[model samples]
Target chain A: MSILVDKDTKLVVAGLTGREGSFHGLNNRRYGTDLVAGVTPSKGGQDVEGVPVFDTVHAAVQEAGANTAMVFVPPPAAADAILEAADAGVELVICITEGIPAHDMLRVYTHLRRDERTRLVGPNCPGILSPGKANVGIIPAHFFSEGNVGLVSRSGTLTYQIGNELAQRGFGNSTIVGIGGDPVVGSSFIDVIAQFESDPETELIVMCGEIGGDEEERTADYIAESVSKPVVAYIAGFTAPPGKTMGHAGAIVSGSKGTAAAKAEALEAKGVRVGRNPTEVADAASEALA
Target chain B: MDLLEYQGKQLFARHGVPIPEGRPAATIEEAVIAADEVGYPVVIKAQVLIGGRGKAGGIKLANDREEAERHAKAIIGMDIHGFTVHQLYVEKASDIAEEYYAAVVFDRGAKQPMVMLSRMGGMEVEEIAEKDPTAIARLHVDPLVGFQAFHGRRLAFESGIAEDVIRPVGTMLERLYEAFVGEDAMLLEVNPLLVTGDREVVALDAKVTLDGNALYRHPETAELRNTGAEDPQERMARERGLTYVKLDGNVGILGNGAGLVMSTLDVVAQAGGRPANFLDAGGGSKAEEISNAVEVILANPKVTGVLFNIFGGITRCDEVANGLITAFGSLDISVPFVVRLDGTNDEEGRRLLADADLPNVHVEKTMLEAASRAVELAGEAPPEDADRPGPSAGADPDADPEQ
Candidate 1:
């Protein structure tokens, strides 16, 4: 019933013995996700949160048939983790680590393109969640309600905030995704939107974009020509001055391009209702679902 | 970080790339001393990060020591592109027989490291690329293949490099790539890569921008951070492990995520208020971090009001509330402050703030209502507790997940 993951999905936690990986692995387990195995180097016999551990993703996959991998490895080792998961033949890989150098991502992205079996979500993102069914990376599951609308965002807390707002509006979500706010990431808006478009359970799409790159503008181009469902969108950083990065490495206004005004204009031209704020965005989505 | 020309040349020289002998000086006396030591006919160049230094008279030829001193006096403390020049680079000038361009930059469209070369090179290279794109020969080197001898040969041949100088130019290209990879540079450009009378290929101008994300591994490169060019709040935030950006407004804004903070700025403006700054306490911010962010924003004299929009995910709303109370203990905050808490542990956070009952602190149930209240209180009108919930307020039973 979700765009990317659901009840059938079996998950493995990479770097499961590390502080972040183990802590969040237990959290996902508590939320009733199918977190069946863990991976850590040279810790093959150890168990975290009662889940069996292996030294390599391939071993975990061979034993548990895990199809998805949630990576919490540090920046230097994150690329290798992603490649190793892909090499192990996982269907989806989500990396939650931040500050991986862009060059490292570039090489990993190059290699991943040649391998057709896997789809990657983020190296600096909060991973995807199918509320009440599966929790992948760190999103608080209790804050959401199960329903038809699909949400994707480039931010962490903002994704939770909007999803919680929709739940508070008596609307439920099919899937909520954080695509990360880095310049180079595993997935893009168009990639996630295309999936949402095909999921029959997803009646509408809610996108949270910010000032940076032409990703949103490029997504607008894709929606104008192909998307049939009503999409409510919000773009952040209108008051942001040119040339200053507003926290995210990718969320910056370079020269005159990638301005919030420019992004809003692009989305509006595509017949999408662009909300001025979070509440306006939720109201727009609610109205469409009605 | 964009290294000034002197720093870039130093990096190039360290990497075995040919560059003119140069020394940086902060005063006219130092410039004259450097020129005397290096001999006459030196070039006095102002050290500034902005472009068009030559057009703005930041670069001048000194035929003698007197001219070097005079140029240094005029160039230092001179303003170009709003940057006040504080240092002068005095170097032994080169006699350029010909000029070409070479660079290694990450091309977004190609998704690879690209080596660019052109016969037409100089300050006008930007114009050349924009107008006649084909004049530049760009090669997107496969990371696996990397910059190779054949790739260097292709650049040399395609850019119309002279037959006698082709090998030297190719060598320079390889060295440039080495410098780019070795320094973890985002951009390495030698505009006007000069061929001298002695047939030596040298970098006439060096400009390198290091990847800030990769600086953790290169602590030596990290020391090259231009503290003089950094904003005080920006430098402080970087040291404190907080993401902060200073804006030209009066409303002090703080939030949990970058996206939420950015949206807060836009909404605050929509509600007839200007946000003074952008401060993201980050996911799961602790009490000390919350107080540190508060101190940072309160330090801005233009702030007439403060807005705290925390959507607790990894960040606990109760911790943010306690942090706010803790901040009041050590600081003097007279302006109106509004806090909106939602997501995990929100009600507990709200209760913590309400029980404390700090003066000039108000909590609204929704993000929009909170922003509206903050803007209202920032002006002459005081916020009323009667407007706790709006018609579309998310706290209604159907919306509340617990119900």
Candidate 2:
């Protein structure tokens, strides 16, 4: 019943021969993800972690019926990898690679819009994981367990930390998706939040956001009008001063509107509980649940 | 990543765009010579990355060589919004009949390349956008179609550009778009594209920002970056491969995770303290990384105190503690340091710090306590080095500790 990915979800690791791809693929298998096949151009016959390798996503999907793809390709080649997976009808494409140029992602995003049926998680993100059912990308498998809440964020490492914090408080997740840290990601907080809202299994949601962009404001507006389920949000970059760009390309507060105060005000106005500390996020969720 | 207007014009000139003849000068003497070469009635613009240079007294018109030298001298050493002006650009001024604006930048919400054109130019475009947003014509260009002739024409017409100048305007827009995409620019602005008395369109001003991440692909653009405009701490951070940006505050922060670092900043503020800078040493940081981070923080005279907030996961807490201990020996850090280490091997992390027996160092259990200590220490003056026990003055107590 998990959204985006589950036990029945067959997965293919794009760029599986690379160090990061191989490492995650091996871990994916170990974590009980249906690691069906691997894709690396010109390495068709090679096998990684006993999973068969193919030359392209199309061939890999054709042979193994893989519906989900976890991409580990570098920045320059990430756009092509996404399009290849989308063209092959892979339902969910999770890109774990960071620093894909914004222009390249804009092209991929345009293509994704026309496709309609395919959904993407990131071009510079840590992938999604449905505890017990599937564990894709790099989130530690033990940090999450099957629960009624959904978690989504623009940060990779933060998502992992938040999930662990929630689990420690005995509040598990239905699914956790890291939408990525790039400014021009394929999907956003609103897209993931919408999916979580629609999922019957997800009774509540935790959204971790950073400074920069109108994504937080846009999501708040969306949640105010459409969402019925309670949302607990923790926005980062509050201590970040105006005009200082942070680590994530997306995490910049250039103007007055993009400041942390502005974002927190917008979210609070939407009736979403906003927590200041990482440890307080679960507590906020608990209060929202009540 | 932000290029000064003069540097951007240099890039535009390379792309065949008609930019006013200009050269950047560091001194009034050089500026006088440049003005002489460009002819009289030149424009002396202070070379800065920030906007609103015109209103900030950064841009001035000089009717003669004497005026040019005077303006250059005044503008070069002036401080506009915390950024000191070190260079002045002397350029041939254009005769203007009409002003137009055009730019190509990534529109995050649209997830596409957005082309913004306006009939109103040479003013704060943001204010115009707020007051009359529709006055600014925005078009999302398909990456496949790109900045084609038709796209440019549509943008020009929508901007209410004159019919006679539409062709040239469209052509210029297309060229600018090409420059934007080709150069991996985050922003390309040609403000006040002047239609002269003779009906010739000329770029009066140029501003461009190249994406730093894409710098690896464009080495030439990378070379154009002026490190003088950046804060010393920011420059140091870039060299160390750490994502650090200096802000005005007293409490200096060092953390492993970006999220944790950000949260720590908020925590500092919420606890009624201001963080001096944001420094993320990255995950799995060793002793040297911590020491380097400490050195950068110490380099800033604004940073009155130091705070180390680490939530160990893949990054072991003991590793950070050892780094802090080692930093005591390497750097003559006179400022107070408040350390908070939690998660993996927490006890060992605390034990390592305790064994170091360093003065002006306090260990706290919670992030709040550590932040409070940092704020408290920042409020007080640093203890005298002669009076305090130096690293060499103490015995190596943890020299033969169990692994």
- Give the per-residue lDDT digits (tens) of candidate 2, residues B102-208: 88877676666788788888776776575666667778788766888888878887888888999888888888888888888877888888888888888898878
Best by lDDT: 1
Positional deviation of A132 in candidate 1, in angstroms? 2.0
Point out where model 1 deviates above 4 Å: B97-99, B124-126, B149-167, B197-200, B376-403
True lDDT of residue B120, candidate 2: 84
The DockQ figures for the candidates are 0.42, 0.33
lDDT of 1 by residue, B1-403 (tens): 7899988999999888899888999899999999998878899999888778999999999999789989999999998877889888999989988888888886543557788777767855556566666667777788656789998899888878778888888888888888887787878989889988998889989888887888888888789788876778778887888899987667889999899999998888898887888999998898899999999998777788899999998889899999999999889879989999987788899999999999999999888888889888877422323522211201111111111
lDDT of 1 at A86: 96
Q: Can you tell me the CAPRI class of model 2?
A: acceptable
Off by more than 4 A, model 2: B63-66, B130-134, B344-348, B354-360, B380-403
lDDT by residue (A1-290, candidate 1, tens digit) is 88788898799999889898998988988888899899999999999868999999999999989999999998888889999999999999999998888788778888887777898998788888898888899888888878998999999888877887788889888999989988778789999999999998899999999986778877998999889999999999988876677888778765565678888888999899998888888999989988
